[model samples]
Target: MLKWLRPLVLLLLIGLLGIFGLRWTQQNMRNAIPSANSRVSPIILVPGSSATQERFDAMVNELNNKTKTTSSLLKVTVHTDNHLSYSGTFEPGRSHPYIVIAFENNDDGYSNIKKQAAWFNHAMTILSTRYHFNHFSAIGHSNGGLVLTRYLEKYFNQQKMRINTLMTIASPYNFSETNIDKRTQMLTDLIHDNKKIPSNLVMYSVAGTENYNNDGTVPFASVEAGKYIFQKQAKNYTQITVTGEDTTHHDLPQNGEIVSLIQQYVLHISDTKQRPDVNVRH
Candidate 1:
């Protein structure tokens, strides 16, 4: 009876530790950067792997606070819906220059690559018709990046729609054949078979170097080389490096350098038509 009780207590302790660790990580990861208070544009915040709309509130708030300049050129509104639904008017006066953010957890068992693409297409159509936003941009993290890429390959290739820029943070664009997930496989095939899903979208990828082995969740090769694959396939592409003290995949979004890099990218997109070049070494 004493031995059995000890084992039970150890198991309970381990479970508690696991739960606490997960919660701590999540708390650290949950953040938002609000569009700077100016005359910029409205942005739609998309979640990453296992992420919900609530997680992006911090980053949105930060973005809103930091982009305020005398020029008053950067005003942003945040739309937070997991299903990509928009409420109210999306007209020029109402909503323009929308930024779609894709995160990993949003792709659950029920939500696949194709479904996400359809949702994005629907959202783009509604915004384009109602708000006249011909040029749209997307920012995705991890698997969320994959979702956006897949969407571009499948739906936006033929349409006259314009994807101004695509920014991916620590995204896994490449995968090993032996350890490929179903969803990843689908995305890889779509990217490889460019003829099947041609696109002219500009892409930007960011990764770290210290943790070349694994950034907690994604390996270095997956994050760095993945963008190269897109560059090889597309005409316009660039990659940036943001090294953090943590250097873990989970910490990239929260790191100061990464946050600044992302803000600059967003600002560039808001101001001009051309994609800005960025390179953050170390």
Candidate 2:
């Protein structure tokens, strides 16, 4: 008789969990980004395969501190492990320039991009719920770009997550020819499926070379390969290649030169028009 009661109690616990899950989903959806189409979209920075969120601290400072730059139009509020949401305003039309969501992927997504990208999708959901942002712009360094690229392929249209711009810094898309997760071909496949990619999605491949050829870690050719693919996909693919001592693979996110260029060149939100004549082919 006691064993029979156990099943009944287990059923009640399961029902409670289901109800809680549904409540959480509803609240998350309701608080996502607004849909006005004219506000400054949130900017998201995702680090590379083994890096942490601290990688962008210097760059984030540069962006927030710039006095007369396009990137300055947004006030960067980095979301850390302890803090889940911005302490300030998430609204766009007001005093805030832009809300930057810089998060760390605990997994770093080193091995499998598909699984990694799925995790990325979930992170975005949490951000959406927290900030209630309507649209967003994305920046990824190294393999982090692969995760975002795959996420777009699978879930971009599912919830109308408007990604107006995507910027990849020193990412090695074609690192291996025979690896199970052909990171290079993933972008190629994305380009092949360009029609599905939103026209408003402008992608920039920012490559840096420490020496004369490679950016310490990623090859110049690998980053530039997306030039045509973004063009074909109507993502307005732009390739920026910079030669300098400070622009290493790891430093690309924090390099002052590259950061200034991005501020003047790639960053285009409702407040600022796209800066012109920087190797853009769209």
Candidate 3:
């Protein structure tokens, strides 16, 4: 009886040690990872074809130049050679930072857009690990919007991070077609793949009109085609048409009114209330 009791006590002590060791290991691992408060939620931007990460510099300047509070800017370019180059730094403790991602082969065409989507995913994996964010907002201009849409459908992993809002500026979802009745192959594919888009996302599609029917580069009909892709899929979808002196396709990104729209819709500002007197068409 004494021998049996001594063996039982030894086994109990070993089990206790194992339990405490696991607890300690778990605690240390949790401590190593940054808490949600410590992590930053970023607004990521992607430029159109032929534009680099610096494409948004003027817009960022316009954003920071205002009397309103400013967030830091960080530019990251993923080269075709499988290396990343970064510029700028995040403002300390800034919960909403701006991160612009551009590719080395920023070419036009559908095939290239697909490759950019893949590259965008690779860049995101590294960025997510570095920033430790569980969510983000996205802004894409022109072809960049297509890239983001493709990424969301094919490569985005919601288990890692969620996308809350997506704003597409002057994206020709149907390419240069002026009639929504005529859908391009790209638009058809995007429509078919719409189910993969997150249902809780809030989407804003902004179309710039330099004339009655177009933004001087992309047709208004082409931009409006985004409705087919996001209207029913996203939780909330709003289409805004900005018409003014600088509402051209290239100028839309830096347009003063567009900048204000970004501040009101995209950023984590103190005042997010909508103005009653906005002149833009909805």
Candidate 4:
């Protein structure tokens, strides 16, 4: 009689439950993963030796003055104990947040740079996990650039988070050695690991020159030696020697011309002025 109808009803009920269960699981999964629009693309900056997370405050203020909207600044310090301390907040709906990472042991030297790179990797891992960003831009000044180079060579994984652009300001790739022929141990190591740098990366190596041959701190040849590391590996390696007021090694970070370059290249702002001496290396 109606026995066949009961069996059909039971099958329909079971099918409905399975469909609902699947939808619930999918909804939860979607909730767990951050959407593309919700994710931030921060410009992570590493300061030079003896500098702290507050190193870029003045520069950032100037950057914000040029922008229509003000960006959030987040400073993070990685301690020797592997702990992290943070200051500042990320404003909602802001895609281009500025993040500065400074190490507790912010000293100069090859060994310290290596340690800084390792610390940077750890900090970046935590940052990526917390913020859910899949891409970022990088800027490093002086020894900070060396740390970033080491990190890229050893720890950076493109599959995890893509590096959009890299700008190294007044970085002494040859470490105070003015002669390009006399490469330092650090330079040699960096060149040897050049292949590890992302092929599609657009890198800008900035050399600040107060005089014709040097930046007052880093020699012109020392900074120019970045060509050996990035020229073949990167998609576009540009060597820009910025000469004007405040072109010294430390002041280069806050130079007006450098600010313009950052706006044009790193921030992707249009109609920015470029200096005449900007050289593009193949």
Candidate 5:
């Protein structure tokens, strides 16, 4: 009995040590990584509701191709976890000045919010420390937009980071009246309480005119709230309305005019000398 008990105790101690060592290693890695502000032309792309990195592949490719055509010095990349695993293992050559898209196929929504925020924070840390980016832009659609906004409200206040442009397409900024899922409601509340107005941030909200007050999944009112929230927080607020389309909220990102509008907005913000034709398909 004594011999068996000794082995069991040894195993327990080993397990505890392993856990502590893992946590310490994680902390060190996080500390070692830089912030989002350190990257050269950094842009963090957050996907809309129920979408993954694959959804933004076309857009990223287009942006990268366009950037390559304009300047060889500027690098554009998308940060995605292999097999939808969010373990913070960023591919070697694909780091900052890149996009971070979230993918969750489970019913646990609150966890998704925390996970997304952690991923964004980790990426931002890396960008802020290693590259020292002066400007950072985040683009999100639907709930993805909300997640980014919530993160900004929570962490941006403490960090010395500046957001150049924040664009949300078909985002449900205020889902109070709607019958959204509980997780979404919690996210909305979190962002509402954490709202900050009139910093040096430029915000844009785009909404479509086809679906029951929203582009499709989210109501137009929610999208409007996104604009209003930023307007209240920032002196420089821009809202672009994309009308004449029968696209639903889910399809807004795919709309030609909407895509064109986004292209124009980004070009204007980046002060690019040339503008690309917004010929995205619906």
Candidate 6:
């Protein structure tokens, strides 16, 4: 009986020690890599004016396929919606290295920028507040680029929202009719203003030239306007021109070659190849 008691006591002590060791190992791992819930910067994908949500879907899938990650393209169908707005999992979170939110406005994020920006404002504010996102990366195409510019003018550098990098694909910043408004004026003004906007922001203005020297939609100059607008801060400015094939203004989001350039700028892929058409003046 005494022999049995001693063995049982030894077994109990070993079990307790195993539990303690396991806990210690978990704590050490937690301290090293940080937790899964640790905050990460979000990438916001905005479609061009009058563009459909489906337009970005293939691109999103492509990004996932290329990176071998499960990063999701979160859809906010309505600007007024909040965290409860969309439903989906992190898709096993196995490949998800970061978060991507693709914003789709009911009004198509065009027609009227001031109003469209309002939707971006409401949605981003709620997301930042809810998720505690401190920094962001922005990508916009066509008039969607204008929306990002407006969003920065309103929210960036504020206590709530901040952006690190901005990419505008075939954006017509020189569109004649938009400058009459005060907000548009402010966007350009802020860029050139001496008060100084955030020094951390790096902007890429990407243009496309098709068969006829035009992007089949937006003129080459219109896309290049960003270089001038952000000229004073040249270090923060980059102008990229993707020419050839179906690399039209509308085809930019889907073009693999151009998307690789985007990967070079944003995702920082391993590709050593660089296209001559891309005039990266960073």
* Top candidate, metric TM-score: 4
Point out the worst 10-residue segment of candidate 5 by lDDT: 69-78
How does residue 260 of candidate 3 score in lDDT?
81
What is the TM-score ranking, best to worst? 4, 3, 6, 2, 5, 1
- Over 75-135, each residue of candidate 4 has an lDDT whose tens digit, in order, gives 9999998899999976636748999999999989999998999999999999987887777
Write the number of the candidate with greater TM-score, choosing between 2 and 4. Answer: 4
C-alpha lDDT score of every prediction, in listed order: 0.56, 0.64, 0.87, 0.88, 0.59, 0.64
Q: Which candidate ranks first by lDDT, i.e. highest?
A: 4
Model 1, position 201: C-alpha lDDT score: 53
Q: What's each prediction's clash count?
A: 29, 8, 0, 0, 30, 1
Worst 10 residues of 2 by lDDT: 72-81
Error of 6 at 258 (Å): 2.1
The candidate, 1 or 4, that scores higher on lDDT is: 4
Residue 169 CA displacement from its true place in model 4, Å: 0.4
Residue 135 local lDDT, model 2: 78
Question: What residue runs in model 3 are displaced by over 4 Å at the alpha carbon?
Answer: 1-38, 268-282
The weakest ten consecutive residues by lDDT in model 1 span: 69-78
Candidate 5 stretches greater than 4 Å from native: 1-39, 62-97, 103-111, 130-134, 157-159, 176-198, 269-282
- Clashing residue pairs, backbone N/CA/C < 3 A, model 2: 32-132, 33-132, 33-133, 33-134, 34-134, 74-97, 74-98, 75-98
lDDT of 5 by residue, 1-111 (tens): 998999999999999999999999888776542344443555566775467655555555455454442211122222435223332223324333454555454112555
Q: Residue-wise lDDT of candidate 2 within 1-282, one digit each (tens)?
A: 998899999999999999999999888888553346535566777666666545566776676666343342222222333334333334455322444433443444335666666656666776666556657777888877766776777666534467777888877666533232345546566566656666667788888888776877877766766654566674477888887668878878878777776575545313356577689577
Where model 2 places Cα greater than 4 Å from the true spot, the runs are: 1-35, 38-40, 68-111, 176-192, 266-282
By lDDT, is 4 or 6 better? 4
Candidate 3 per-residue lDDT over residues 44-163, each given as its tens digit: 999999998889989988887752557789999999876889999866366478899999999999999989999999999998878777788999999999999999988876655688
Residue runs of model 6 more than 4 Å from their true location after superposition: 1-38, 80-84, 87-111, 176-196, 272-282
